[model samples]
Target: MTQLKTLFFAVTTAALAGCAATPRKYDDESSRALNLARAGGVYDQDLRDSPDGTRSYRKGLFTTLLDVASLATSFDAPLRHLSGTQTFMFNATDIMATPDNPSARPSLIGWMPGSLAANQDDAYEHYVTVVDEAITHAAESMSITATKLTDVKTPEIDEHPLMLWSVTSERYDCGKSNCIIAYNIQQPTYWKTPSYVTGREAASYNIAANHPEEYSRLIFRQSGDERTFPVGEFYSAVSADMPPWIVMYFPPNTVFQDGEPLTYPVLYEQGQQLMFKEPNHE
Candidate 1:
C-alpha cells in the first residue's frame, strides 16, 4: 500500500476509538507500536518473501503488538507480545547445520515426527541452527572465506535457523531514480565493507558512476576495496521453501520518480534483484 493509504488506514483505525461523542486519548506508546508494526511488515517481508510476500505475512500488516491499547494511546504496536531474544529464538530441534553432511549436499531440516513431542519437558532448553556451510561455500565461490576462529560471530535472533551471505567489495549500479531495492542475505547480519563507503560513493566512482539519483546495498562488505557478489551466478540450491523469488542483481543504472524513469544507462542485467513491492503511497 502507498504511504497515503497506510496513513488513511491508521487514521481511520485510530479514529474508531471515539464512541458517539468522546474519544479515547491517543498515547505516544501506541502510536510508536503502530509504526513499528508497519515497518516490521516491510523489513520482515524482505527476509521471507520470494520477490513478494505471502498472504500470511501480508495479513500481518494491520496487526500490531496490541489492538485496543494501541488505538487508545495512538501508539504503534509492538511487533510481538513476546519481546527480547524470545522473538528471535527458533526451536533448536527444528534447525540443523547446512550441507547435512559435508560429504552430501546440504538441505533444510527435514520433518522428523518425534523431534518435539507434546508436553515434552525438555523442549525449551535452547534454540539452535547449524552454521552456514552453504554460505561457507558461497564465500568460497567468491574467493572470500573467514579464518578459523574459536567463536563464530552470527546475528543473534529468535532463531530456528539462520544463514547470512553477501559479496564483499562488490559494485553494482542501478540507474533507477529514487529507486528503492530489496535484497535478502541468509546470514544473520551483514556489514558493508570498504570502510565508510556510501551509496553516493558508489555512484560517484564505482559501476554507477555514470548514473545519479540514489542507490545502495546494505551490510555490504567492510573491505576497503570493491568486490562483486557474483550473486547472479549463485543460487540457494537448498531453501526448498525459498520465497517465490529473491533479489538477483541491480541493473547497471536507471532512476525513476512517480513510477517513471527519469534517466537511463544501459545494463546487461535488467535490475538489481527483482522486487515485488507494495505500490508507493503518494
Candidate 2:
C-alpha cells in the first residue's frame, strides 16, 4: 500500500507539471481517413483494457510471521497475500447511431467479450447485462431508439452524424469479506462525419461535439471486524476528445454493509462516490 501511494504521487506530479506530449497534427483528409480506419471494430480491445496487468509484493517478515500463524491456527492466510494484488480483465462492445438523420437509428455491434477469469464469468455477465441496460437507457434519455447488436460486426457509418456508445465492466470477489466490488467504465466518443465540414476551425479538421465522460469503480476491503468503504471520484471529462454520456447511476465512494446483489441502483450510488477519492484515477 505504501508503494502504491508513492507511485501515485509520482504520476500526479508528472501530469501536473505538463509531462504529457502533444498529439501530432494530421491533415483534414488524413484525419478523417485515419479515424474511419481505426473505428471499424465493434470492440477496441487495446483501449478497453488499458492498464491490464498484475502486481505482487515480495514476502516480508510480517507476512512470513502471518504465514506461520496460519499453519498453527484455524485462521486463514492474511487477505493481503491471498488476494492483495489484482489481475483485471474487461469485456467491451460498441454501438453507433446517426441521430441527425431523421430516418437513422442506433445499432449495436456484436457482443465481443475479452478474456476474463473462469471463476468470475457468471458474475461478470450479470454485470454486463446491467450495464447494457444502462447504456440503452442513456440513449433513450437523448431521445433515440436503441437495439442490441447481435450476429453482426462493424456497421457502415462513414458519411453521417455518428455517435459511438461503448461500455466495459469487471467484478472483484471479496473472500471472507462483507462487500464485493465491481469495477466498470464507459467512454462514448463520436464524430459528426457529416457530408460537409463545419466552419469551426477545429471542426474543419475533425468531428466535434461535447458529451459526458464517465468511469464507475467499486472496491471492497476488510480490516478486523470493521467494514471499510471505497473512496474515489469515478466519473469525469478528462479530455474533450473523448466524450462519454452521463452514466451517473452508480454513486462513487460508497460501501455496502450487507451482502446484497450488486444491482444498478447500488452501482449508481457507488459510481457517484468514487470521484473524489483517487486523485490519480484516469
Relative to the unseen true structure, what is the C-alpha lDDT of residue 275 in candidate 2, on a scale of 0 to 100?
A: 18
Decoy 2 TM-score against native: 0.19
Candidate 2: which stretches are off by over 4 Å? 1-118, 154-282
Local accuracy of candidate 2 as per-residue lDDT tens digits, 35-78 = 22112121111111111111111113223212211221222234
lDDT of each: 0.22, 0.24
Per-residue accuracy of model 1 over 62-162 as CA lDDT, tens digit each: 23321211221221122124332222221111122111111111111111122332322222121111123433454465454322222323332233213
TM-score of each: 0.24, 0.19
Q: Give per-residue lDDT, candidate 2, residue 29.
A: 28
